[model samples]
Target: MTEQIAHEPLDVLRLRARRRQAGRRSFRQALMRAATGIIGEIKIASPSRGRLIDNARPPASIARAFEAAGIDAISVVTEEDFFHGNLALLSKIRRDTRLPVLRKDFLTTPYEIVQSAAHGADAVLLITAGLADDQLQPLLSEALEYDLDVVLEIHDEQELVRALTFDPSIVGVNNRNLRTFEVSLNVSKRLINRIPRHILAISESGLRSPTDVIAMKQAGARACLIGEALLGADDPRAFIAACRPAFVA
Candidate 1:
């Protein structure tokens, strides 16, 4: 029998785990909350379990559909292993759409922030599960200097407190737990009340239908980051358009 091989480094895994302890706030939390539109998250991950259709749509094609649906932002996953995303793809998507682009990656160091800005990204995703609060603040300030938005992603209440320390303009409650990789819509509902009305509150992960989007919005999510469901659809634009009537015009 062949032995399983490790793909990610132990140090990288350690760095990601350490982020839960260093709580901080971010400036972008407010903008995300104030946003009146959806934030379309793009990913070209290895196919999901039991996937029947092999014809996953190209990133650009999907991005165009997102733009047509009037999304507030576009987040391109740059991680390669699980998501099969690339930084170069982000640059490509940026050239194709007027919407603000967010580089979604497990960003650990300052160099990565510079790389994101240089790559033509308008924003960067800093997960609360990936960086210490102290480590996150400086990076937040630096990204701001470049005029890039910073969206902080947190998994739970502890992470939320840490996220708040940075005073984020947008704070996303990712329903997917990094450790367990489980998702629940209630995650957004549970965290919404704790966040001030001034900050933009967003729900990330596991949002599937129009009903799901509405539920999230009612739970105080200014916007919802949707990807898998849209990308999996036969016509992403049509599906997204169908959901538009529910949001305030």
Candidate 2:
């Protein structure tokens, strides 16, 4: 899988995991109290679930609906092989949507980051498990230099520690395990407590209902990158509305 690769040695993962834990008061407060943002996503397919749309609407149209739903951000998956997503979709979404657009893909190189910027991405997804610290450091630095926000994704305690080495302000705890392609809310519930303050926390994948969305927030996620469930819904607008009630005053 593109999500699983060894750029950093195994010892690095072990060593980083050994670093100081982040269960401080300030950290816990940041996770629990921050106002949550909604990050709706666009993708026509998935490697694990097959096709998402029978006749996919144009990226611009999808972005328009999501914007109308009052989502805080837009995530456009651009992985061509598995998701059938493309850079053109991202560029088109950027042009159509007033919201910030995040380029979600299996980014492994600095080149992909550059492409994300050139294509009108306001941010990019970087999975810690996909690249080593040696590669992650330079690529992350380059993304910032390009003025693109980085959504650093991690799955477990080890990956979370490894991700912290870069001092990212935005973190994504994916509920779906990339290696096994299994979905579970426990992943985020278990890992969210470890993430500290001043950083925006996002829970990604397998969020299927309003209750699921609320649960993620209570577990310390400040946002969610929702795609599949939203795409498969009978009423995308209604579903989006439901996911946000817990966050509303």
lDDT of 2: 0.76
For residue 212, what is the lDDT in candidate 1? 89
Model 1 off-target regions past 4 Å?
Answer: 1-36, 46-56
Which parts of model 2 have CA positions greater than 4 angstroms off?
1-36
Candidate 1, residues 14-98: lDDT per residue as tens digits? 3432442132222254234333467787777643543222455567767888788666678898887777788789879877876
lDDT of each: 0.73, 0.76
Provide the TM-score for each candidate, comma-separated: 0.81, 0.83
Error of 1 at 3 (Å): 28
lDDT of 2 by residue, 38-156 (tens): 77889878776788766646667877987786677788888889899888888788778677778899888766666566667778889999898899988888676556778899999
Candidate 1: RMSD to truth? 8.0
Q: What lDDT is reached at residue 114 by model 1?
A: 62
